[model samples]
Structure formats: C-alpha cells, structure tokens
Target chain A: MAVYTEVPDDELAAFVKAYDIGEVVSFKGIAEGVENSNYLLATTKARFILTLYEKRVNRDDLPFFLGLLEHLSAKGLTCPQPVAGRDGEALRMLCGRPAALVTFLDGVSVRRPTARHCAELGRALAELHETGKGFALRRPNALSVSGWRPMAEAAKGRSQAVSPELDAIVAAELDHLEATFARLDLPKGVIHADLFPNNVFFLGDRLSGLIDFYFACDDAFAYDVAICLNAWCFEPDQSFNVTKGRALLSAYHATRPLEPDEVAALPTLARGAAIRFLLTRLVDWLDTPAGALVKKLDPLEYLKKLRFHQQANDATAFGWRP
Target chain B: MAVYTEVPDDELAAFVKAYDIGEVVSFKGIAEGVENSNYLLATTKARFILTLYEKRVNRDDLPFFLGLLEHLSAKGLTCPQPVAGRDGEALRMLCGRPAALVTFLDGVSVRRPTARHCAELGRALAELHETGKGFALRRPNALSVSGWRPMAEAAKGRSQAVSPELDAIVAAELDHLEATFARLDLPKGVIHADLFPNNVFFLGDRLSGLIDFYFACDDAFAYDVAICLNAWCFEPDQSFNVTKGRALLSAYHATRPLEPDEVAALPTLARGAAIRFLLTRLVDWLDTPAGALVKKLDPLEYLKKLRFHQQANDATAFGWRP
Candidate 1:
C-alpha cells in the first residue's frame, strides 16, 4: 500500500495532456505495486496504470524494464504494454519521479491459489521465458547467487533478533549456495525473479496477466521455476504441497520441456531461491524502521522454506521426477 | 491507503455470485477511504466499489449509512448507491466484517481545490441536505459540541506533546464553545459532518459526487457549512481564503437559503468544527499504536485552523453576512 508521491491536480492534468488518452475521467492511487506509486488512470480513451517509479527502483534499469514489457506484449504475451505519449516516449517524469502509463490488464490476483492456478502460472512462466529469448535487453539478476552473500552479510549480527538460529543458518546457506551455484550450468534466459501469487492475475482459472517486472532479469530460467516452487507450491503452514508442485511442473514442462541438466539442478536452485528470499526478507526485517508505512513480511516464513530445501535430495522431493 | 482485509479469491467469487453484477473481470484494492477496505470491483456489467467496513466503523450504524446512500441516490443526488444482492440485502458479511457493494461513481478528487471547486462543493452540500430531509433515519453527530469535552479529556496531558500550547488552547476553547453553543439556535437537519476535499469528487470543474458518509448525522446544517469552510476554503499554510469562502457560501445560499440565525452562527460553528477535528485527530494521535497500518494525521494542522476560527466574529468573517 504505497502512494508516496502525491500528484497535484493541475500537474496531473498537464501530464495527461501529453498523452493521447483523452481527458481524465477518473484517477485513483491503487494499492497494487509496492515498489512504485500506482494510479488506476481512466481516461476518455481507456484505462491505464500510471506508475511513478519510487527510489527503490534503479533509474538506469527503467529502459530495460520498459523495453521488456514492450517486447513481451508485442510477442503476444499477456502483460502491461507501456503506452507511449504524443511525443512517442513511453517513460516520462511525474512529481519528480520516473513515470509511465501502461495499458491496464484486467484480472484479480488469487490469495489462495489452487492447483489449477498453479498450472496456469506454470504455463505463463514458460511462455514468458520462451518469448523473452529474443528480447534485446539484458539485466543480470542482482538477487541471484552472487547477491546472496552481500545480503547475508548486511543482516549478519541483526538476523538473530528475528530468530536465534537465523544468523547461523543464513551464513551456512550463503556459503553452500555460493560454492554450488557456479557449477550448476542450467538454462539461462530472462527470469521473473519475484513471480509471487500477488504478481500473477487470474480470470477465474485462466491466467490473464503477469505484472511487476521490476525484478525481471537475465538468470537461469529454472531458477525462475524454483522461485515459483517456493512461492506458489507452499502451504500457509510452510509445508511443501507436492500436488500443487506437480501441477506447476507438469504444466511448465508441457509448454517448454525442461532440459535434463535444468531438471537435475532444480533442488540446488530451489535451495538458492529459498536463501535469496530469506536473506532479503531478513534484511528488510532488520532494517525496516519502526512505524514505517510498509509492512515487513516475516523472515521466518522464508527460513522455514530454506529448511525444507536444505533437506531435499533431488527434484523428486519437489514432486517432479527427472 | 487501506486494504486491511484480504478477500480470498474463491470467497470473493462466491460473494460476487450473490450479486447480479455479472462475472468479475477485475478487482483491485484502491488507495481511497481510510476507514474501510475499498476495492474497485469491475465486472462484465459495470464498475462498482466493494467496501469491507473495518473495526473503526460501528457495525450497528451500517444500515443508516447504506440507507442514506440509497435514499440520496434515489433522490437524484449523484453518489454511490448500495447495490443490493439477490436476497435484496445491501449489507452482508465478508471476512467477518460488514461489507457492501455500491455502484461506483466516476470523478477525480482534487488535491488543491479552487474557488470553482468550492462553489460546486457548496451547491452539492446544500443538495445533500435538501435530499436528506425525508430520509427515515437519524444519527446524532457524535463529534459535535457536546462530544468535544470527552475527546479533549482523552488527549488531555498528551495534547501538549503535539504542541506546547495545544493543551491550554483546547481547554480554553472547550469552555468557550460549551458556553456559546446552546445559545446559538440554528437550523438543524442531516449534515455531512466530514466533507473534506477527498470525500468530494469532481469532473473537470463540476462536482461529481459526495462520499464517506460515516460522519453524517443530525446536526446544525450551518455547522456542516462551517466544516466545509474549514475544509475547502483554507490554504495549505492554514490561512483562510476569503475569495473561496465567498464562492462557497454564495453558491450554497443560492441552493438552500441560510436562515439569519444560521448565518449569524457561522463563526462559532466554524470554531466548533475546527476544535471537533482537532480533538478527534489529537485522540487518534495519542491512541494510535506505533507501527499501525494507518497514518496518524497531525493534530497541529487542525490546531492552526482552530486558532483562526476562534478569532472570527460572524458569518461576515466567513465572507457571508446575515
């Protein structure tokens, strides 16, 4: 729930004049994206999402994100297409922040995703990966294997405040992941690093759109699959739901068959995914200021996930026999 | 920005199935209305607002609020009419909170309201009061003159922490207001006690609709006028803008002529209005738990407004003469 920048009425009117979207009928700040201020903008022409990119998003990466959306939408993938203004620029400035108007996608995000939702998500992920192959831009996943050690170091002494065993567990996992990640030469492509259920929208059982590409980067495609395994296949009690995992994996495999190496590396990649989230969530837990606007998710949730991944012997543990 | 209650998809689907609004195409939690969890629910038929009443709103008062919207909208006042379900009930349960779906009104809320906007607001306020006359419900203003003392007492010692002079000013104002309020016998009716800029929507320069009637009650109509004077006719620096006040008062008088006594009582009522907000905001400032989801509005802003109102003489001071 973020609307950090308040766009003045006259300023917003002026901003809308640049677009061909007609007179603003209704504009409302929506509790959608966390990384940016998102307004559900309705004009005489159509509905669009006006996003003011917050400080958390790197300005240098805006082009890559915008370009990827444009590329994906052009390739017939279901995503928000960046709408260009009369000046033919998709990105502009609003209230001193980098802003863009993207076509509004119609769908509701499922809170408790079922096996069908998981299957739909799996197919969408594979389609995204396949379509992303020909995209021109390349961005390294900053939260990938190489990034885990720095995040762990940042939360070193403070992580114990969240849990007594968190600090040691995180350190061991970082060392293990860092040593093993380089050797696992898995399929690499554009990966939606944070394709949580909240980011995937569904029209009943059908996946209508995927959103929040701020975390999209060039990484092992199977790693994206692993992220999904952690995000979509986990029960509220932190137990892995093999039924959901099998549904997700089977649907994904049917769309884009997983490489033999990619399948074999799933357990290690899943472990890395767990540690990545744990470290980031731990850092957020340690650093979030008291009385801050944003809610800090429990790091222990990811810690429980990490524990499960640590014990897994092969992809079979994830309900996928490779 | 509040979406405290997360509506699960299947539950929401089931909930929407009860309504005749067609299949749900999209539903997004909107960053509007702090008192309730508001979602912009778009279906195959039309767009509507799905509001889950939070704990802050009294469940007992839900009928009056919903009924008032129904009555007002029925009387041709442009507002969100509560959409009744197949059971003919507008009020129902969702996530254990009293919930209702209302026809979505279209318009944008102005961040910085102009004199024209103030005039439109004035006419609309009068229309609301006129239409609310025959409504078969009564809710006494809970934050009126009689209610100030209790709220002030709740924030007694803590008031000074917000400002050095707040305690003394609040105490003195309470004494002054208690003595003066009963003497000023003014026109009484249903009043929109909270008509701040955010609660009123505009299409270009036209007043589109009035909303958030949680504070609506049976009170002095002029006091409601005073609330608008304090809300819409004030500059950001807390200075009273007479031009805007004149526009607002004149437009309101054109729609519903103010009685001589009601006109004469504007100064005291405006002072009362200012103190009413100051006390409530101060209480919220004092009682809000640290790290709570809602943002605590600064009581100092209302403190400044109260000081301005205390110095005013009569309706003439508000750019209207009895």
Candidate 2:
C-alpha cells in the first residue's frame, strides 16, 4: 500500500489544467504502485491514474517507461497509455515530484489464479514480447545475473537469522546460476521482469489488462517466461503446480513458438529468477525492523522453490514438453 | 491508510452477486477513512465504496450509523447513501468482517481550506444537523466530555515526556472544563463531531459532499460547531484565524440561527473541544512506538489551540457579534 506523497487540491487543480481533460470531479490517493504515489483521478472527461514518481524510480528512465507503454498500446496490448498535456508532455512536476497521468483500465486482479488464468498470462506475455519489437529505448535488467551476487553478499551475514541453511543454499546456487543462467542464445526483447499474479488483471476467465511496468527492461524473452513460471506455478505449500506451468508454457508457445535452445535453458533461468527475488527479499528482511508497518516477506519461500528447480534439469519437469 | 483485510477475488465476486448494482469492472483499495478498509469499487452501473469495518468500530453501532446516513440523504443532504443488497440488507459479511456498500460521491478534499471553503462547510454542517432531525435511531457520542478524563489519565504519566508544562496544563484545563463544558441548555440534534477539513469535500469553493460519519452522534449542535472551529479555524502555526471562524459561524447561523445560550456557551465548548482532541492525540502519541508506519500527530499543536481558546472567554473573541 503506497501513497508516499500527498497532492494538495489547489496544486492538483492547477496541474490538471495543463491537460485538456475536463475539470477534476473526484481525486483519491490509491494504494496501488509500491514505488510511487498513485491517485485515482476522475474528471468530467474520464477516469485516469495520476502517479507521482518517488525516489525509488529514476527520473531519467521516465521517458523509456512512458514510451514503452505508448509503443505497446499502439501495438495492440492492453496497457495504460500516457496522456500528454496540452503542451504535448506527459511527464511534469507536481508536489515537487515528477508526475504523469495515464488512462485508467478497468479490471480486477485475481488473487488465486487458476490454470486458465495462467494460460491467458502466458499468451499475453508472448504478445507483449512480440509487440515490443523495434522500440528505440533499451534498459538492461538491473536485477539480472550481474545484480544477484552483490545482493547476496549484502545479505550474507543476516541470511542465517532468516534460516539456518539459507546462507549455504544461496551461496551454492549463486555459484551454479552465475556459470549457467542465460548462457544460451535466445530471443531478446522488452520483458516485464516482474509479471507476478497481482500485476495481471482478469475479468472472470479472460485476461483484461497488465499493469505496473516499472520493472520492465530489455532481457531474454525466455527469461521473462522463466520468471513467470517461477512466480505463477508455485502453490501455497511450495509445491510445483505442473498443470499450471504446462498451460502457461503451451499458451506462450502457441503464440510465439520457443526455440529448442530456449526450452533447454528454462531450469537454469528459473533458478536465477528464484535467486533474484530471494536475494532482494533477504536484504529487505534483514533491513526491516520488527513491528514495522511494511510486512517483511520471507525469503525462504523462494529458497524452497529454488530447491525444486535445482533438481528439475529439463523442461519436462515443468510439464513443458516441447 | 487502512487496508487490513485482503478480500480475495472469488470472495469479492461472490459478495457482489448479492447486490444488483452490476458486475465489478474495477476494484482498487483506497487510502481513505482511517477506521475501516475502503475500496473504490467501480461497476458497470456506477462507482461505489466498499467498506470493511475493522476492529476499531463496534459491530452493534452499524445500523445506527447507516440509518443516520439514510435519513440525512432522504432529507436532501449530500452524503453517501447505503446501498442495499438484493435482500434489502445494507450490511453483510465479506472476508469475515462486517461490510457495506455506499454510493460514491465525486469531490476532492481540500488540504489547505480557504475562508470561503470554511463558509461552505459551515452551511453544509448546519444542513446536516437540520436534516438529522426526526431520525428514529439514536447513538450517544462516545468521545464526549465524559470520555476525556480516562484518556487524560492514561497519558498523564507520559505527559512530561511530551512537554515540560503538559501535565499541569491538562490538569488545570480538565478541572475548568468539567464544571462548564456542555452544561448550558442548547439546541440538541445529531452532530458531526469530527467535521475536520478533510472530512468535507468541495469542487471550486462549493461543498460537494460530507463524509466519515462514524463520529456522528446525538449531541449539542453548538458543540459540533466548536469542534469545527477548533479543527478548521486554526492556521498551521496554531494561531486562530478569526476571519475563517467568523465565516464558518455566520454562514452556519444564516442556515440555522443559534440561540443566545449557545452563543454564550461557545467559549467553554470550544475550550472543551480543544481538550477533547488534545487528550486523544496525547494518548495516541504516547502509545505509538517510534518508527511505526502510521505517523503520530503532535499533541502540542492542540495544546496551542487550547491556550488560545483559554484566553477567548466570549463568543466575540471568535468574531461573532451575536
């Protein structure tokens, strides 16, 4: 739940006047994006999302993010389109922070995703990758292979407190993934690196929209698939849901068929995805004090998933028989 | 920023089935009301607020609160009306907590309210009090003068930690208020005891709606005005803005004239109002641990307001000639 900055009424009214949208009807601080402050802005014309970028998001990267959304929306993906002001600029300053208004999409995010939802997500992921071709901007994934070791080193001392075996397991996995992960030649494009279930919205069984493109960057399309497989195929008990994995992969394959090289790299990339989240969560858990408002997520949850990926060396183990 | 309960998609869909409003098009948890979990639920018909009552609000008082809004709306006051489900029941269970849906009002709450806004708020407040008449159900004001002593006692030990002169000031003021607070005969009706600037919404100096009725109860209407004077008439520096006070009072009087006794009792009521907020804030300040997510308000701010009201012994001090 994030509403880091409070936008005053007079400032907001003046800010909205820059755009051609009608006078503000209703505005509310919404608990949406975690990295910035978001307000559900309703005007006489339409409803939109007004986001104030906080310190977590780099100001220089705003153009890339907004441009990608525009590019994807033009390419027929259901995503937020940045609404430019009368001055032809979407990014401006409001409340001493960079802000932008985007068209609001209508859909409710599913909490417990079914196999059908997974299939929809898979097809949507493929569509996003295919549509992302020829975008001028390029942002390398910051939390990729090069970012893992530094985070693991930072959380090394306190990882034992989270779990007795966490330090050993992370160290061993880091060595293995660094040598093998993402080594194969595969398709590269703009991948939504963090396509978790909460980021995907659904209306009944149909996928309605995908949101929170903050973590998107240029990475292997197959790596994005691996991230989704790690994120969507795990049950509450840390057991692998092979049916969901098969549905997700087959749907993606039907949209854009995966090469054999990409298929063989799934387990290693999946393990790398697990490490990426585990290290970040480990650092957060170590830094957050007890009784803090933001609940600290257990890093060991990903460790359990990592253990399964370590044993599954082939695509068949994930129910993806290409 | 309260979103305590996580209502799953299946539960929310099932819950909305009982209502005839339409299928949910979008749902986002909103950072509104402090006491309950509020979600901005947009459906095919129109937007509505889904409130899941948290533990702070008593379960037994739900009907009285909802009934008061119904009565006020029927009397033509702009407020959220409770939306009944198919069975004609407004309140139901969702995610193991008592919940209700209310029609959404379109307005923006002001951060720094001008004198004009205060005048508009005064008229709307008077309208609320007048409309509150003839309501069958009744609920007592729990945070009235009777509730002050216990709270002050709880914060007495930590009072010195907050300020060097805090304990003595509170003790003296409590004794004085115990004798004169709410003793005079005044017009009694349902009062919005927490008519702070944020609780009232506006669109270009016109009052669009009033909200957060959890604090509404049967009490002296003049006392409610005193709460507003304390809440709205003070500048950020804690100085009383007599101009704003005059605007608020005169506008309210124009809507529903105040009796002579009510005018005479304004000073004591305003002083008592200051103490009421001062004690509650003091208790919250002492109880909240450092580094908690919810920001703790400074009790000394209200102390400054109380000091100003202490010297203001007559209604003329508030710029009301009557």
Candidate 3:
C-alpha cells in the first residue's frame, strides 16, 4: 500500500549532510502510505522524516510541495521544513526519484481531541491559510468541477450501488456551482485540500505541528476553513457536533474573520468539496486491488456530505453567522 | 482514467444471448468513471450499459454486485437488470475481465430536484433498505475506524502547510474518532454505499431510476438513511438548508420510518459517513497520479457533514420526531 517511492537511508544521509543540522545516525523506512515512502532519520543533531519519491507524486511539483513547507515553516507556522540537499536545493533526485528530508516534528498526533482542541485547530488553520497568501505559486483548485467528473468516469459501470440519481445530482450540482460561485469576489490564495484529523499533531491542548503538504495549492481561503470545519469538529459517529463546530469556527473567525464573499460562497464550496471526495472515494471503491492492505472507503459517505452541502443555506450552522 | 476494462461487442453479444432482452447491435464506451469501464450498448430490442470488471471489484463478490442488480430489478426498484450470457450466467469473461450487460435506464438526473423529489428519493432509499433485507449477501463497512489510521499514515510525514494549532486539532479529532464509535451496534443489512446526487434520475419530479450499485453492501441501515439526509438535503454551500433536509428525511420516514434503535445510532452513523469520506479524500489528495484526470476532493466537506450529523442528535433534523 505504499503509494510513493521509499526514501533511501544513504540518500537521506546525503541530504542531511547538506543541512546546517547534524550527522545522520539512523534511518529506516516507514511503510505506511499509498503515496510516498518515508523514513524516520535521526542525525547527530536533529531528527527528520526522509521521504522517497512515490510514483503518484509529480517530480516537477517537488519544489512546490517542499518549498511551501519551508516557506510556511519560515513564516512561523509550526510545520516541518524540507531540508536542502547537497546541491543547496530542497528538491533532489534520490533512488532515481525525487526525494527530500524534512525536519522531524515532536509529539504524536492526539488520538482523542476535545472541543477546546477543535477550537484551537480552527484558529490554527485560519493562521496557516492567512500565511499561505502570496505563496509564490499559482495552481488552480485541483478538485474543481473540471477535475471531478472525469474521475467519476473511471469507476463507472463497476458498481451499481451508486444510484444514477446521485450522478444526476452531481451533474446538476456542478452546473449550479458554476453559476452560483462564478460571480463570488472571494479572496483567492493557497489552501490545504486535505485537512483531515490525522494530518495534524497535537501536544496536549496545544498544537505541535501540521504534516502532509501534498494537497496544498492555490484556491479559496474559506475552502480551507470549511475543510477544517469538516475535519476537526465531527463527533465520534461522524455527525456535525455543533459545540465543537462552533468552537472551531469561532476560533478560526477570531484569527481571520471570513470576508463576506468567502462566507457567502461556503455552501457551494462545501458541495464542490463533497463531490470531490465522493468521486475520489468512488474511484477507490471500484478500483481496490486484490490483497491490498488498504481498505476501500465508502463513496456514499461523501455523497451524503455533498447532499447535505446541497441543502445547506443557513450560514449559522457553519458557525459564521452574518 | 477508466479504472476497469472495456467490454467488447462480441462479449456483449455473448452475455446477452441467454437474457430475454433483444440484440446488442452496438456498444460504446461511456467514458466517465474511474472505478469501472462502462459502455452504452444498444440493440435492436433495447439499450443497456455493458460494464467490464476491473481491479477494485472482487471476482468472488461478483454475485452481490450482479445479483443485487437482478434482485432490485425484480422488486421494481429503478435499477439496471443484469443480463445473462450465452453460458447462462449473468457474469462472464470479456476483455480479459468479468463483464455484464444491463438495460440502460431512461430519463436524466434532475438539476434542481423539488422538495417532493427529495422526499420521494428519501422514501425510496428507506424502502430499498427495507427490501434489502434477506439480500443473500453481506459485507462489512469498508470505510470504518480500522481504515482511518492507515490512510492518515499514507499522508503523514509529507510537509504540510498547516499551522501548529491545526495539527493539534487533527490529532485530537483522530483520537476522538478512534475512541468513540469504534464499536457500536451495527444493524447489518444491505445498504447502498454510494448514493450520491447524480446516481438518481428523475422524470417530472419523480425518481425515474436509481443507477449504480457496485458499492451496495452490508452495514447499518440508519447509516444509509443518514447518508441520504446528507446527500439529498444541504445546498452547495456548507449551510444547513433545513427545509430540504426536512423533506428528504420526512419522505424517507414515511416509507420506512427509522427504528428507535436506528435513531439512537444516527449520530454515530453520520460521523462514520463523514469520516469515511474524509479518509478517502485525504488519501486521494495525497496520491493522485500525474495526468490522471481525477481530482482530489476537500476532506473538510465530509468533516462539515460530520459536524452537522453530530448536531443532529435528535430526529428533528432528520424529520423523525417520533
């Protein structure tokens, strides 16, 4: 299930040599993801996560992914900075694939976070989004309408579980979104497309660091907030816990009060986001390889999310009341 | 991005030989999904969708996927019926994969479904769950708690552009999700796993057909209804559109009112649905291949939906006051 290439110890050692930190004393592959292979490398002076270039990752986009990490880290964001290689570069070739080593963050991710933690995450997400401005690169939202339908096509005809009504709803929602959000004056900037609960790490009630920059790209700032609202505030059963939802949103608002335009466009953004997940999950569901340790996620989950977003009109539920 | 194999004309013809349907004069690939390869097959007697099996589908589970189609068709559920091949089998080898032919449905998905449509679809979904009993096959929830951490691990250690607070929130949420709802009374039954908006087609405010059944499997029935609530209700934005939510849930309740046991589990089911989406979208965000038309959806949208379900502790939002 390791999607990406595994970073080599020797290569990571070479990158560590380039850093202003310490000597590489240890390194090992952490076989976990379906994207990039990672190794926890400990140097004489510091710890780092050595990443191997996985097939799914675009080598060309390494600078964007790694550089953004450095940029955000330098801007006082509590993120792991990608270390420059021997060529005085963050991007480098390793094991015949693009690879890099990042500063190892402290503390394990909280397996159980409270409402206070949710609120803190909300505010922190706002801060990171605020810092993502003028991030030196411009990329369109990768999961926009133009990007969704095609994926849905890949998994078509395999599963009869997806009601055609759902497909129609997606098509119709796409059109509505195009018309509805086409005119919004929402501020545009870099946003984290995947702000799920596990992508973050906390040290007690305080946040230690944020990991996984693979989905960072130019898009709406509010979208990032919405993602956070969706990720951090849910109850155990996956329902929207208003107490946590409000706390998270309120924290986010306090840090970077949403612009009226961004606030207004939330419903549509929510739908767009929902459709995006539904399609990806659907594709995954239909294409899970045999003997793959990876579990196929239910596409219906996001379908429901999109359906709810479709019905969403009260800004209050989002805890961003006018 | 076609995830599966293409069904050949000869193969389509072979598969339809035993069915009561007419000749398959033509079959054209409907290049849309990333899960399965779908072809619009037309014959002198009827039009149908010829699906070629791909990796995500298990050959052993073909009976469930194919049989459910036939079963629903028998019950007058607006679904595509599986056509047997010359060998007297609904599933046959074609294009080096398992393939089947289904009667193509009539009517387009509604762009702007009326409240009645929402209610009707909800009721239909409930009825489908009711009828789903004794469905001869069962599969556990594919995107349950056991699936979350692995997905998170996939995206971990990859430079995130998130703030410390955001990281903490994610860690905390993961913990909470793992601790709670990790185990619950799962009223197992056949439930459609991907009931998105576009999967249903409507003709004049009535649900003409419910297409796509590849993801139908065993799980909590209320979770299915919760999925409907999330999908049928909600607007494009993240706001809760109570009216539509009400109509959809009410209509569903009218046909197959939720059991108190089901209602008790609604909150958890909603959360499960939300997390199911959050994880898949997160994985996609981290792993989409280059040149793959698939887009990574925002994980937060599900996070928001989860939040709403968390808030919906009572049956009011679900339109089930009883």
Look at candidate 2 and tell me the lDDT of residue A322. Answer: 62
The lDDT of each candidate is 0.89, 0.90, 0.68
Across residues A201-292, which tens digit of lDDT does each residue of candidate 1 receive?
A: 98879999999999999999999999999999999999999999999999999999999888888889998888888888888878888777
Kindly report the docking quality category of candidate 3: incorrect
Provide chain B TM-scores across all predictions: 0.97, 0.98, 0.88
Q: Is candidate 2 or 3 superior in TM-score?
A: 2
* Docking class of predicted structure 2: high
Of the true interface contacts, each candidate retains a share of 0.76, 0.84, 0.00
lDDT of 3 by residue, A11-99 (tens): 44455566677655434344334477666555557666777777777777777887788789889999889887556887666778767
Model 1 C-alpha lDDT per residue in residues B91-188, reported as the tens digit of each score? 99998888999998888889889999999999999999899999999998888888888888888887777888888888888888889975777778
Model 3 TM: 0.48
Q: Which of the two candidates, 1 or 3, achieves a greater DockQ against the reference?
A: 1
When candidate 2 is compared with the true two-chain complex, its DockQ is 0.81
In model 3, the runs with Cα more than 4 Å from the true position are A1-20, A31-33, A111-113, A162-165, B1-322
The Cα error of candidate 1 at residue B31, in Å, is 1.6
For candidate 2, what's the TM-score of chain A, rounded to 2 decimals?
0.98
